[model samples]
Target: MRRRRFVAAVLAGAGGTAALPNTAGSAAARPDSPARHATGHWQPRAPLPVGRGEVGTAALAGRLFVVGGTVQEGEASPLWASTAVHSYDPRRDRWSVHAPLPKPLTHVGVAASGGRLYAFGGFTDAVHLNPQPDAYAYDPRQDHWHRLPDMPTALGSIAVAAVHGRLHLIGGRDSHRIVTPHGSPVSLGFGTVSAHHVYEPGTDTYRQAPPLPGEARDHAGTAVLASRIHVVGGRVEDVGDNLTRHDVFDTRTQRWLRAAPLPAARSAGAAVVMNGCVIYAGGECRPGSSTDTFDDVTLYDPHLDRWKNLTALPGSRHGFGAAHLNGQAYFAGGSPTCGGGTSTDTFTLSLHH
Candidate 1:
C-alpha cells in the first residue's frame, strides 16, 4: 500500500500462497543474532512493468495477478486510473502484461475462486468520486474476462474473503451524496457503508448478509484464520480517522466477535497470514508525520492474541497488494510517497520464524 488512498481486504477458502526462493539468511546461519529473532528481513524481487497504486492484486492458478489501479507513466505524463492486469511468475523471475479489464477500475476489491479471478466494485477511475457496480471474472485458462452480475449495491474499496465456496464482501463506500447547508461536503464524511454481501459462485449471483457492527469502516485488513474472518485497522468515516478496532466474523455462527486490536492504527495496508501468524503491513498513519506511509510490519498470533512489530519495510508505501509464496510474503506495486508517485519495484518479507 502507498498509504495512497487507503482500503480494506478479505481472503476466503484456501487462498494460495507463493513459495519464495531462499534469499534471506536463516537463524542457523546467524548464531549470534538477537535481531533476527526479533523480526525477519525484507527481500527484493523483479519489479512490475508499470508502476501503480490503489490497485487490486490476487493469486490464482499459481501466479500473482496485479489488477486495476492508478498508474503514473512519469512526471510529464498525466496520472490515469488503469485497467492493466499484470502477473508475476516467481519461479520464472519474470512478468507479463495480461488482458486489461473491460473498464478502467481503481480501488477495486479482488479475490480468486472457482479457478478464476473475481473483481468486485471499484471507483470508475483514480479520481475516486464515481463508484462502479460492475463485477467481473477472469479465466486465465481461456485468457478471457467476462462480466458477472453487478453487486446489489455499487460500492468500492471493500474487504473480500472467500469462505467455503462463497465470497464475502464487507464494508465499502458509495460516492458521497449528502451535502451541507453551506454547500460544503458533510464533515462526517462519506467514507463507509455497513453492508455485507455474499457471492455464490455456483449461482453466479449475490445475496445480502450481516453488516459490520458499529460505525461503517473502510480500508481495513481482512483474513480467514481458524475459520473466522478478521477485519482490522481501517478508517471509521474518513481516510485520516484510521482505527485499530478488530472485528471477527464467524462464518459458522454468522456473527462478529471483538478480537485483539492492531498495535498501530492505519489505513490502506495489506493483510496476510502464514505459519499461524496473521501479518498486517504497510499503509498511511498520521496526517503530517514525516513518514506518513508505513514501512513497519506487525504480526499477530491468533492463538496467543498478541502483536509483535517485525522489521520495517525497505521503504514506506501504501495502496499496494500482498501475496505469500514459498514461506515468504511479497508486496508489489504501490506509491513510495504517502500521497503520490507509484513504484514498479516489488518487496518481500521473509517469514523465517
Candidate 2:
C-alpha cells in the first residue's frame, strides 16, 4: 500500500486533531537570521544492507547499533516491522549483523548504559498499531539479548535516554483498548501518552517518574546532558499534529524546565548529544498529498539556552538513526520522503572541527 493510503487507514481508526502551527517565538535562529551558522560538513558512510525507517539507534562500546524498524520492499509495497539488528564499526567503516529482536517491531526506544544496550517499548505491527510493553537488554560481549521487565505502560515512538546509570523512558503513544462487535480486543484506535518510567538495570525494577509536562506526544527528539534530559518536537496526537515544544527535566532537582522551542515543528527526527550540544536532524511533517520531510540540521546550546542552524542534511528524511561516536555523529537509514519509502543512505559529520 502507498504511504498515504496506509496513513488514512490508521487515521480512520485513530482519529485526528487540529494541526498546531509552529511557534514563531522560538529561541532558535530563523533561516534568514543574521546569526552565524555552525560550520560542519557531512560525508557519506557505508550504507545499510537493507533500507529501513523508524529504527532505534544507539552507540555502545565504540560501535553504533541500529535495531528493529519498518522495512519496505518497494515504493508500492506495504510496510512491515523488522527484527533485524545491525551494528556499524566506525573504525572499520563496515556494518555487521547481530542477534535480532525476539519479535518484529518498529519505533522502539533504545539507549546504551553500563556497557550494555537496552531497548524499550515499540509497535509490533505496521502503521503504528499494536504497541508493546516488552523490554530487552543486549550483551555485546556475547552478542545476545536477554528479556527484561516490561514497561509499566505499552507504547511506541517513545523517547528514551540513560541518566545516572538508569534508563528513562519518556513520551510515546499507545493503542486504546476498545472491544469490537466480534468480541476482539484488537483495535487500531490510539492516543498519545505522557507516561514516564525509570528502569534500574541493577535491581530489575521500575519506578514511575513525573509525566511529561504540557501535551502528550510521540516521536520527540531527546538528548541527555549534565544530568538533564531534553525532549524536543513531537506529534501531539497524530503524525500530522506536530509540535515545537521543548521541555527539559533536571534529574537533580526532579523538576521540569522550559527551553527554547525548535525553529520548525518536527517529529521522528534523529537526535544526539555531540560536543556539548544537542544535534537534531531530519524529521517529517504534513503527511499525504502535501507530504514533506525536513532536511534542516540544528543544534541546541545548553549553556546559551538557544538554538542555531547547522548545515542542512544532504536530503530530506525521517525515522532515521543517529549517534555520536568518537567525536563524529553518524546517521543511517530512513525514508527519503515523507511516509513509507526507505533508503540505505548513511552519513557522518565530524565534531572536532
Each prediction's TM-score versus the true structure? 0.84, 0.85
| lDDT against the true structure, each candidate | 0.74, 0.80
Candidate 2 clash pair list: none
Worst 10 residues of 2 by lDDT: 4-13
The lDDT, on a scale of 0 to 1, for candidate 2 is 0.80
**Residues forming the 10-long window of minimal summed lDDT in candidate 1:** 13-22
| Residue 194 local lDDT, model 1 | 76
Each candidate structure's count of clashing pairs: 22, 0
Q: Look at candidate 2 and tell me the lDDT of residue 113.
A: 96
